[model samples]
Structures are given as C-alpha cells and as structure tokens.
Target: MVTVLTSGLASSLMDRLRRAAMKLALGEQPPEDLPMIAALALADGLESPALVELAGLSRRDPPADIRDLFTEALAELGLPMPRVEEAWIDRMLDAARAMLSGSLSPYEASDEIYWCLCHLDRTDRVTEPMLLFAGLWSNWEDWPDGRPTIEQNMREAAADLLRSHGEQVSEHE
Candidate 1:
C-alpha cells in the first residue's frame, strides 16, 4: 500500500479522480469526459490540458495499457514522463487492477494512486496534479477546523486554474 500525507485538497482531488475513474469504468460517463473531469480535478496545473488532450487522442488511438495512456497523456502535454522503477509500477498496476475489480474501495485505490504519482513526481521533478494535490491536502490538515470550506476552495481553485488555462471548467454540484 502506498502512503501519503492526506490534506483536504488532496482528498478532494482524489475523490474527484476516483469518482471519475469509477464512473468511466462503470460506463456511467463517456470517454470524452475524462479530460474535462481531470481538468476540474487538477485545476490550473500543467496536467489539466494534457489530460484533456490525452482523452482526445485516446478517442483517436486507444492505448492497450492504461499506464501507456498516462505516459502518452503527459507527453502530449509536453511534460516528461517520470522514470519510475518497474517494481513500483508493477505494484501500482496490481493495486489498480484490484481497485477496478472491486476488491479495493475507490478511496483506498485513489490514495495509493496518489502516492504512486507522488513518488514519480518526486523522482522526476515534474509538476503533476497528484503531487500538488498531495501537498495541498497535507497543508489543509494542519489548519484548525478547515474541513468544511476546503472542498469549496478546491473547486474554486480548480475553476481558476482552468480559466487561467483558457479551458471552460464547470463545477459539479
């Protein structure tokens, strides 16, 4: 299992990603929505447009492996793919598969995924949503009685990020 210092921002983004991934996996949402949802989750980070573009590219040419898709997405966004150890990738893949198969809850899976992403970010020095979200999530936890407003702040930040990137972001509820 991967570990991360959870904060409100990280929790919110993880929730958003997990929900989007689940919805996509369950066929509740169209493939095109993935990037938009990712953009919303990532806010104004470098990964947002890349995710959106990745979804578009996936529609044109789907990759066989999800990891490949993720790599390609980052590359499409002009970001370098982090060099993660094969062992870590294998472990994450196993965990992710378990999550998709319903052996793990979305929350658990997202947390692990966040850690994996963080590991990659730390190793590569790249700016990714998972890394940023993890930091924010950790910082938020230090604040006194900050939970209630954190979610809203996260959304607003995401919206601001999207708008700054010239992408139209809509708040979900």
Candidate 2:
C-alpha cells in the first residue's frame, strides 16, 4: 500500500472533507450534493454552487490526490463517484480557507468571495473585521463592472448582518 503524504494544511482540509462526507452520508443529503455539501463543510456558512459546478466540469481531468480521496470516499459509502474536477476542488478549498481566515484582500475578492460573503451575511455570520477589510479594499474606481464596489457591498453586508443580529448601526457610526 502506497502511503500518500499530505501537507499539514491538506490533511486538515481532508479531515474536514471526510467529516463532511460522512455527515452528509449519514444525514441522507443525497450523494449528488457532495460537492456543495463538502464546500459548506470546508467553509462554515459559505456555499457556492457555481464553484462546485466548476469543479464538476473539470472532474474529467482531476489531480491524483483528489481522485484518490474522492474514490475512497465513494467506495466507503457504497456510492458511485461523480465527475468532480480536482482543480476546482482545490480552488474552492483554498478560497474557503482564505475567506474563513479573513486573509482575502478586497483586491483579491472574486465573484466567488462576493457570493460567499453574501451567503454568510444572509446567514448572520458576517464579522465586523471582515466587513472592515472588505470595505477598505472596495473602491468605486473598481466599479463599472456592473456590481457595486466591494467596499460598498461589504459595508451594506455588514450593516445587514448587524441589523439582523439586532444591532442598531447609526449612519454616522
């Protein structure tokens, strides 16, 4: 048996992924929802189906480690593995860590981060520091892309989250 070595971060991520797969399997959340469920597990309160779909679209050419883990999980669960690409999976995993750790700068924010933040905000999980960081990087100069600047969006998101949590944020404050 070849022992595959995973980095500390990878191991942590894999552990989370395994736990998520087990939970979804035990909870009867349907096998097809694995990618999204896994994404949610990897990033608390963050859900991006587009990212999951992108991973699926790239599954035909997956990395060895991803394939190994995916195959192992499916086999253990007696479920047929679905087409999920490693590249997208890795991207989603990395994004999950970045967002959760508040390491993503506004300049580095992509549609994925925006959507994830929106989801977190809706779920009342948005934090003050996260909002400040997002706002700091969110500038109108980056506008014209149709979507509002990250700062504006983050500020609004922060307000919404605060409001949902019963906090009254004054306009001046």
Candidate 3:
C-alpha cells in the first residue's frame, strides 16, 4: 500500500487559512496561483505544520509540481479541495443549512458568515439578498437558547436568502 502522509491541516486552523486565501483572492491584487497564496500566507506570518510544509515546497529547486503540492495541501487542510468554481458560495450555503439543521452551531455559522461577507469581493454581481443576509444574519449579539422564536426567525431569513441565491433547502426544512 502506498500511504500518503498528509500535513494534517484539516481543521479550524486551516479553515482560517482558507479564509485568508479568499481575502487575498478578493483583494485588489490577487496572487498569480495557489502557491503564491500559500507563500503570501507565510509572508503574513501565518504559521502551521501544514503551512510550513507548503512553505518548504515553495523553496524547492525549480518548484516543480507546486500546483500538485498546493492541491494536496488544501485537501489535507479540509479546504476547498475540489476546486469547483462555486465552492465558496456552496460552502457558505451549506454552512448556513448545517446551522439550521442543528449540525453546526449558530455561533460558528455566524462567525463564518461574518468572515465570508467581510472578505467577499463586492462587485456588481452582489445582490440585494446577499446584502440583506450580511445586514441581518451575520451579526447576532445574543442568541438565547430559550428563544425558539428568535431562532426560527433567523432560520426563515436564512432560508429565504439561500433560496434567493439558488440554494435548494432540505425537504425537511
């Protein structure tokens, strides 16, 4: 068996790295490629076992297979490994649905939404529903456990935003 050793970057820490890459990609001057993104993360003083491994790869002679290495790193980091064009939007909607389904905590979802919105590339493509979601759902000062009505309202708003954005809500939802 040919066992592949991963950098073990698949967790919240790596998720933060993914957000950093997204922010950079959305920035005025995006990096040329994924390795540059990783390099910039290293330049930004973001360090981790996995990030360090990627950085080492960046220093290689000829830097052969950087794309492959970068892709592998993302996979190990539980990042947008599939590299689908819609991965970012899909992740946002999926995270929101998980929150509604009780699989993901509201606080985590709120944080993710806040981060996503702050880093989003605001262009003509942005819609009113996206704005509404950012204004309404991203910030929750106090999500009281006893208030089922409040949660329901949040869920409804999220569902509307998801539907407007073309995300299919679960049948049970």
Candidate 4:
C-alpha cells in the first residue's frame, strides 16, 4: 500500500508539472477553447472552408491530429476515414520541425497545422498521423543521414532523452 500510494503521488506531481510547463510555454493563461475547437473539428469533419471559419474563432490551434485522430475515432464511430491528400506530409514535417524547436509549441504547432489544412491549398495542409508519424520517423538513432530538418531531429532527441528517463507521452485530452 505504501508503494502504491507513493506511486500515485508521483503520478499526480508529474501531471501538475506537465500542466505548469505547458502553461508557462504558452505564456498566456491557456484557454480551454483550443481543445474544444479541436474536439469540434474532429467531431464534424469540417471541410477546409468550414475549418478556416473555425480557426478564425479559435484562440488556439485546431486539432493537430485530426487526420489520425479522426481516422481512429471515425473507425470507432463506424464512419469512413476521410481521404486527405498525401502532400500534406511534407507540410506536417515542416511544421513538426518548427514545433520541435522553441520557434513553436505543440499547441501552436497543432493550431497552425490545422489552420493550413483548413485554408491552405490541397497539398499545403499538413495532415496527420503522417505529420506526427514522420516527426517520429526522423528521430531514429539508426538513420544514416541526419534528419532533413533540424527541428524534427531535436524533437526526436528530446523525446528519446525523456523516454530514457521514463517520461511518457500522453494523448492530449
């Protein structure tokens, strides 16, 4: 029981720490609007035009993982996964690079990526898990050539370092 209690306390502390870090990084009282916007975009499968309108209303970025999250979520909902173009992959990679660096936070990254998807050309939008997946891919220790983007490499390195210390990534709620 003592061990369980200690573990619970540690987990709770970690949660608090993560929240504090995110809030500090955002530099503003983070609004709940971003997550809600994400949820709305995910739920409605809002087209690019609609998404642009949605972005205008958001104080934060749109759902970053809409493509992947939607794919998974829609699968569960017994709906077909929407087929966004593949060129979005490159855009996602670029966005991921920006995100990994201090140039952008995950929230900002997710927001802009979603914004581009909603407003930018068909190929210009960064679609996900591919966006997210590539960021993961470029981080491999075994990759002979360095990652095409410094930001992605940094993100991968940071994630790896954190994992080594037993830090785990959680889904955004």
Q: Of the candidates shown, which would achieve the greatest lDDT relative to the real structure?
A: 3
Worst 10 residues of 3 by lDDT: 1-10
Candidate 3 Cα outliers beyond 4 Å, as residue runs: 1-66, 69-85, 123-131, 134-139, 142-147, 170-172
Candidate 2: TM-score?
0.27
For candidate 3, what is the TM-score?
0.44
Please, what are the lDDT tens digits per residue for candidate 1 over residues 1-173?
11232466445445555444444433444654455555553453334444555544443354333335544554443334433343344334444444445576434544554565554435433245465545555555666477446534444443443454465655552
Summed backbone clashes in each candidate are: 3, 3, 0, 1
By TM-score, highest first, what's the ranking?
3, 1, 2, 4
Give TM per candidate: 0.28, 0.27, 0.44, 0.21
- Per-residue CA lDDT of model 3 for 79-154, tens digit only, reads 6543333445656676677777888665566455545554446664444545655554534544455446545655
Cα deviation at 46, candidate 3, in Å, is 32
Q: What's the distance in Å from true for residue 168, model 2? A: 31
TM-score of 1: 0.28
Q: Which stretches of candidate 2 lie over 4 Å from their true place?
A: 1-93, 96-105, 127-134, 140-173
Where is the poorest 10-residue window by lDDT in model 4? 16-25
* Model 4 per-residue lDDT tens digits across residues 66-94: 32332333334333332233233334444
Evaluate all candidate structures by whole-model CA lDDT and list the values in order.
Answer: 0.46, 0.42, 0.54, 0.40
Better of 1 and 4 by lDDT: 1
Between candidates 1 and 3, the one scoring higher on TM-score is 3
Q: 1-173, model 2: which lDDT tens digit per residue?
A: 22223455445445545544444433333444455544543354222333233235333434443444545544443334432232223333344344334575334543334443543333224444345435444543456473445545544444444455465766532
